[model samples]
Target: MSNTEIEDRQFITIAIKNGLVSKEKVDRAYILQRRIYTQAKVHKPICDILIQMGIITEAQKAQLNAARNVLMGKREEPADEVADDALPDINTARELELTISKDGLQAFIHPEHHQVQDVRIEDLRLFLNRRRIKFGVVDDGQIKSYLSQSPLPEKSFLIAVGQEPESPTPPELKFYFDTNPLRIGRVNEDGSIDWKDRGKLPQVNAGDLIAEIIPGNPGKPGKNVTGKTIVPPKLPKIRLKRGKGVDRSEDGHRFVARTGGMPQLIRKNRVQILSTLNIDGDIGLETGHVEFDGHIEVNGIVQAGYRVKGASIRAKELYNAEFEISGDIISLGGIYRAKIQSNGNLRASHIHTSDLTIFGDVVVEKEIFESTIETNGQLVIDNGTIISSKISAKKGIYANDIGTEASKKCDLDVGIDHRLEREVNLLKADIEKNGKLVQLRKADIEKARQRSDYLNTQLGEIAQEQDGYMVKQRDMDAKLSEAEADKDELQIAFYQKTIRELGEKRNEIDAIVEKYLEEDEGILANIPVYERDVAETEGHIEAAEQKIKALEIESEADPGHPEIKISGTIFNGTCVTSPKATLTTREDYTHTSMRETDVEDGVTTKKFRIKTTSL
Candidate 1:
């Protein structure tokens, strides 16, 4: 029987046997009896005595312990509600938007929406760039919007925010992680599929047994570090036991304390709370998650589970704390005690302050701690020293000076410091020392503008003085125009006269030749030989004409349609063609650039070309 059932049966039997308790009272007294029954130190005889004494009931203790067990973190909790899915399930995958801003990147994290999370400032919140987003830090808020509001710290520790969105999938749903069979052999234990070993296909026992992870928990081995809690009331000694008489007697000194008394008496430094906070988990004294908005500056050590997001954050101390961040971060300290992380610019002075893992660009005025920095822009250092901070930038990193190890992609850059120095100088020269320069510039601009009016007056005086010259220039231009027109007319007329003269000369020569032919003398005798040659050419032409006629008759003709003319031509080791349809033949034509192809494996090179043809 269940513990409750056994306790219930015991309570009923005791009441009935005693013959003093009424049935209604026995029912009500079940809970008090159960507590006495379960108290290991107390005897079963004592429990029966308690039931006989009408002190407690079985059901009430069961209910009480059940609540205590849950509070103690000993019981498995019912399913917790996962965060709500916030990403819209819009049908269209791609969308675009545009807006204008006077403030460029300072006020805006990204120029375009997609590029926001990809954007990062140098050296402040280090780990907030394109590569390697701060893990365990994704939330429902739009990542792009976060960076626009602030710039990362120049040399600061990094922090990340946690607030994972709700699960979109329903209960009983399955998910898969690795599908690479070569690297990690596939296992089909998801909810949709049956549990099957590699290359084997039958189902396993029940769905619950099909989980892929091996069965083991730190319940007995590794420190849970979860269930322990500091007393909820900061000074529980003063608060919880105040009215309940003097709580403790530590040698005439009464102090409010737990049921077991103060930890000081036990000599345990870490104050432990017997009570539970949300299932009685461990109080987060050394290492745990941190979430904040405005600004976080830590003077003490941060051990681990270090996630911080805010408009700005400054950590004086860090030791082995993982960080995810959305905004700016700065740290005066080092990370030898912990690993520092940031989404935005991360700048820290010494190794102890910022041994960093940066997602954004790193701009360290001083030495970079032994850490990995990945950024989208430039890795900059104001000082020429880096103690093994591995850096990578998507766009090439520009360091003012290249260190010996700069060739190794992961090594830090010495050149980054020079650029940083120039930046500092520029800032100083551009603002602090530019007052006199600004006044000078304004005076120069005014003088130049006044010179324009002065030049206009001088131009008028010069124009009057050069009036005669201007008249001469106008006459010369007119003469030049007239001469050009006359030359064109004369050239046309000369061409016509030449043609007429040549015609007359040809007629006179023909007449003389005819006279010579009639006299049967000299050149006229050779003319008959030329006539014979022409007759032979005519005979060849007649033969070609007959062959062409026969071919034309054999060829299929389409009427009232575009004509296809065949002419044989070779160009660039291949055939030349005008625009022609399939099966149409083509030949000799002046090969224009468009008509010629460099014939590669008999494939036609296709390209569009523009050419001007005269009408």
Candidate 2:
């Protein structure tokens, strides 16, 4: 990063020593001059010496732009796409122990890159910045020196969060209120967003799961703030406990979000099974049954013929308990006795339930049944068979014996039957797809069509108004023009400007009307002017388009678009779910959509649903 020049006693003295300045050495020297030193430091004689040696080329200047752009994260230029095969062989990166110039601290390579060049710690840190990764730290030379000399040894880095304070701490979590603007409720404050806090609370059954946010970072993207988000089965008057802690994520009270916020906290607005307060003999719990509500703990062996329901319904030593839940069914005892059908997490021990359907993660101790062994979540089979099923998740499936080929996208363990490998490799394909996405002009077409209708009506109203105004102005004009001298102060500026703007609008509207006539008159020309038919009209929609663009340019200093602004980014308590429409009021680049304006300023994020394709 430095640009300094050495006093060139070498160039003159070296030539004196050799009794001549050879072109090759001079060429190399010029390359060093332009690259390493500024023009002022590198004198005219030395610079000319290198250029005269033919070291600098027009091609090198172009290459510098490509090099600088690639470093700055821009698209590569066409010629720069040349393969590295033409370049010199330079792979074998070696580990180099180097001491810092300031502290003389020898920096050791904890994990060496297998390439040829020594990876400077600074370079490694820069590479990590390109990819925003957490859970890593860059300590100064002092820490590195300490680690090198420490008795514990082999420790590359260490970060320690300080202990909790003696005084009570503030809550780091909040539950979102699903209002037009999201109703943010502090987990620790008075919970009255829900009407239940006003005394008329909603009915809560035994199985209903209630939850609140615990300890976690809560930044919502580009915003300069962070807060933990939590939820419950129903949108209750949320009650978040103060400070950082974990509670009630057991039985059916686990912290998780089925959607929104992060995957942290419990499933919002979904039934969760709570813990069992009683485990008795009279409870006829059996296998093949599932619970979405409160805890179920029974003493007897679950009869294979029956099923039970609730949150955390369990049979003590009961193997063969047929437990079925749409989301998660966690069993502490045996299924040897029963088969469990779960759409979510399934945890059981020494059970003989072969049928396991996990739409989520499944960790089991025994053989799985012919339940298609499918899991949209992770699957962990410790002791038994995970037969014929497609496992699909963003994460991996760890197991001992997987009976069949993976039929879908799955991060499977090392061992699998190679015979059906192709079928097992039905991994989800990541395709970056983009087409014309319906013509961009459809927006213009629709806009033009609507404007035509509006303009026609407005023209009629204005015609009457203008005629009346003209009559009144004629009386005034007659009075002024009759007087002749007072005509200059007649204030025609307002009327002139209005007339000019109206004429421009008339041109826009007339062009669209002609386009509609020109396109459709050959076929079904009789279509009504419904204002919506502009997209279907065939004429020079492009001309109408250029006028709109001109207006947009004029709008730059003209108060921009006429839309009222919402203060925050989130709409209706959710960060916009409609992908194309990134409407937000969030200050962090999330612009809240203005319902008042027909088209947003940034872009008409909504797609143009074209009615016709030919033109």
List clash counts for every candidate, in order: 76, 55
List, residue by residue over 1-615, the lDDT tens digit for candidate 2. Answer: 222123244333323222234556765776666665574563444534444556433343233334434534674662654432211111111122222222111123333332323434444443222222122233657434543442323333332111211332333443432211111111224411231121111122332323544443232222110111222122222233311122245532243333221111122223332333355553353233444343354655456556665433334444544565544444445455455555445555543425454444555555444343444334555334444333332233444444423322112221122212222232111010111212434554455566656656666665676566556555654454444444544455554455566566656656665665555443232224422343343323444345445444432322211111222221221121111222322222222222222244456645521111110
Q: For candidate 1, lDDT tens digit of each residue in 217-333?
A: 222211111212212212112111221111333332233333321111111111111211121222136435666533354555455545544333455545555566543345444
Give the Å shift of residue 585 in candidate 1.
Answer: 63
TM-score, per-candidate, Cα-based: 0.20, 0.27
lDDT (Cα, 0-100) at 192 in candidate 1: 23
